[model samples]
Target: MQEKFVINIGRQIGSGGRTVGELIARRLGVKLYDKELINLAAEESGLSPEIFEKADEKESKGLFPTLMGYLRAPFAGDDGGCTNVLSSEALFQIQSDVIRSVAARESCIFVGRCADYILREHPRAVSVFITADDACRIRRIRNRSGCTEEQARATMARIDAKRAAYYNYFSSRTWGVASTYHLCLNSSVLGEEGSADLILEFAARKLNTKF
Candidate 1:
């Protein structure tokens, strides 16, 4: 029998979280959404994809001026100068709408953007967090990005800080904490394929259905 469910994955940078998501999606014959979500949100909102890309999983920096402009204008000027600015809140709402719509349509894997919290009400949704030790993450980052160890560490710190800030600001729960997820796995300990397999096993058990 085929089972329908949604999987939300929250991952640390260089943890191979996206790779695990892709593997699970393929095994379950479901769509995997990560960067694709930005395009989907852009299409649905009639906004440029670049706008969504810029705001993806990052807090709105230097947006206060634009937000204030929109609040003040409320409508176009006599010269047809549009004062509509896409705030971080607006972008998040649009993406959340897209995420809900897609989840309602079918079972799929959502790689990030706080999908777990967004779909908290879904009965069949399972949320997982993927992380790795600092050394392993640094190594993976260096290899994939062709950076020195110091550069990899810096990159990881910067990206993780952005992700943490985004998640903490938008969601009620704290980011990367074990209590916030149904299951948290260390990709470095298990390896990418092994991590995917474990997630499948856990899902099978939790959902009480075979994959």
Candidate 2:
């Protein structure tokens, strides 16, 4: 078995998934990759981090991203314009590379960005999806964003649609479906810490490791 392992987390916006992933990583003494993938992809691709971030998670609707970003980007050519633009698809590819590279280097927890699919063939990778009931989600969102219940519901719908679209576009599997992941958890049922403990127990058994 491979010494390095990865736990890929798919989370709803207010599900406390990222927080739980952090807890797991801390327990295992491993890094967590989330928005940090943008910086890593930027470094590897020699493009501005802003460019990669704009194309993040969403599927490419066209052949190229707008040149507006390159106008202020340091990498713009001598004519003060972009020499090339990477579509959302291209950026996804680069980010996927960064994901694989990091996971190979050491064990880590990855939050969102379809990491479960990206590392599907890894010898010791575990895939998990997290969800929460509307009440729990509304409370979490209100506390975090100061949004009212209706507004929080709106935000959740908007973001979840985008995430499902992105995941479906890039992978063969469906998002948030039980069959799509090795395990699934309801953050509301167990709360964040309890949910995390259950995940640890499940993953440790699958990975044959102690936590």
Candidate 3:
């Protein structure tokens, strides 16, 4: 019997993480789940796509004070505020459930969204953290988003901050710290294609261990 493997990728923004994940999925003949998870969560929660988009892999920083109106405290609020909280929580539940469903369905590559924590019990799962040099990441961001280096750097920091906050809020493990992942790779070291090949080779060997 051929044993299945799950690859959960945690990556920095503009670090070629998604590109490598897609290539790894293609080479391994597995499904790739990233943005598609958002759609699935929205459908499951019966929420508007915009709500999910706003809450996607993000931490709720609490509601606005002025928006709460006469509502005194955070807990004391109108139906709209309550509804917003409920919808956001519902979306998160759906996302977590969908992630579990995909892991159970088959071997697949999951990019981000605390997938490593989601599949921690899976026997053949490999958790990886992808990052690159600041220069490389800034350049990539600039090219992709047409922003200046300073803007790109700020954007990168902002997005990564959100991701870190979300992950930390949801999971006990820390993000980007060496102890959190089984393996950490710098995409700039080998380029995107080369990094993909290296990861494939490593995963293949790990998968073959039971053979």
Can you give the TM-score per candidate against the true fold? 0.91, 0.91, 0.85
The regions of model 2 sitting more than 4 angstroms off are 62-76
Clashes of 1: 0
Tens digits of per-residue lDDT for model 2, 1-211: 3489999999998999999999898888889999999899999988879887777766566636555553346466668654667667767888899999998889899998989999999999999999999898889999999988999999999889888888888886799999999999999999988988999999999999887
Where is model 3 more than 4 Å wrong at Cα? 61-89, 209-211
Q: Cα RMSD to native, each candidate?
A: 2.6, 3.2, 5.0
**Pairwise lDDT winner, candidates 2 and 3:** 2
Error of 2 at 70 (Å): 11
Clash pairs (backbone) in predicted model 2: none
For residue 197, give model 1's deviation from the true position in Å: 0.8
| C-alpha lDDT of residue 79 in model 2 | 80
Q: For residues 52-104, could you state the per-residue lDDT of candidate 1 as single tens digits?
A: 88788996565323544433454545454654567888789999999999999
Off by over 4 Å in 1: 1-3, 60-79
- How far off is residue 104 in model 3, in Å? 0.6
Give the Å shift of residue 74 in candidate 2: 13
Among these predictions, the greatest lDDT belongs to: 1
Weakest lDDT window of 10 consecutive positions for candidate 1: 63-72
